[model samples]
Target: MSATRPPMTAVGADRLRDELEYLKRVKRPEIVAAVAEARAHGDLKENAEYHAAREMHGFNEGRINELEAALSNSEIIDTERLAVAPRIVFGAIVDLVDLDSEAEVTYQIVGDLEADIKKNLIAVSSPIARALIGKNEGDEFDFVAPNGTKTYEIKGVRYK
Candidate 1:
């Protein structure tokens, strides 16, 4: 059997692609120039600018490699193209009500790379997302959080 690739949203994959393009086409060349210019100035031993440029180059290359690998191993799921499903799944924008706080919040279940709590995007592997998975609207589930266990009721699920 083939290995299971990580599920990533189409938006996430596109963003990574854009970043990779910028790093390779723009950042890499800028770093190369900086390093060359630094090297031209003086001796190699005590050149702080030269070392900094080399470090920046290394970081840029490492990020490029990481993005390339991640993109290669990802399965991009376009929520806009998928039919709406009953259960909360990847690419689902979940509307939930906190049992304790009585607060309503919306979160999109996304890949780890796309998760940002501030933006209301939760990773599929996250505790809340894990508990929310396979659950339908009006269903309640308890999930373990960093603070404590919390209960939430699924209010709605939308693909877009």
Candidate 2:
């Protein structure tokens, strides 16, 4: 059987591609040069510089592999091109309001790798995103978070 592809937003896929490119074109070469320079300094076992460079190289390679795998097994979805009215799905941007605080927030429901709370991009697996899923505009729902349960109102939903 073929490997199942994980869902990914177009933006998330592009970010991963950019990161993979940077690691391969910039970081990989920089680490290789550092390792070479360190190797020129004599003994291998006791050389701290050499060991550190090797460790960093390993990390860089690991990240490259990880990005490659993620990209390979990903099903990228472009929300902007979607003809249907955005109804809180993967790649849709949702606007929400906190019922208690009356504060407003916007979040883009994205893939696991693209989840960055700082950027207001939430993973589909996250509690808030799960709660928001399948919800229509102006819909109210209760979400049970780690802190406690909170009520949220769906102010709007946009595909783009």
Top candidate (lDDT): 1
Q: lDDT per residue, candidate 2, 1-160, as tens digits? A: 8876778999889999999999999999999999999999999999999999999999999999999999988899988887554467778788889999999999998999889999999988888888888888888999887888889999888887
Number of clashes in every candidate structure? 0, 0
Q: List the residue pairs that clash in candidate 1.
A: none
Summarize candidate 1's per-residue lDDT along 1-160 as a digit string, tens digits: 9899999999988999999999999999999999999999999899999999999999999999999999999999998876756677899999989999999999999999878999998999897888888888889898787899889998988897
Model 2 spans with C-alpha error above 4 angstroms: 1-3
Q: lDDT at 134 for candidate 2?
A: 82
lDDT over C-alpha atoms for residue 105 of model 1: 94
What are the RMSD figures for all models against the true structure? 1.2, 1.3
Q: lDDT (CA) for every model shown?
A: 0.91, 0.89
Point to the candidate with the largest TM-score.
2
Number of residue pairs clashing in candidate 2, backbone atoms closer than 3 angstroms, sequence gap of 3 or more or interchain: 0
RMSD of 1: 1.2
Candidate 1 lDDT score at position 29: 97
**Stretch of 10 with least lDDT, candidate 1:** 80-89
Each candidate structure's TM-score, on Cα atoms with residue i matched to residue i, is: 0.94, 0.95
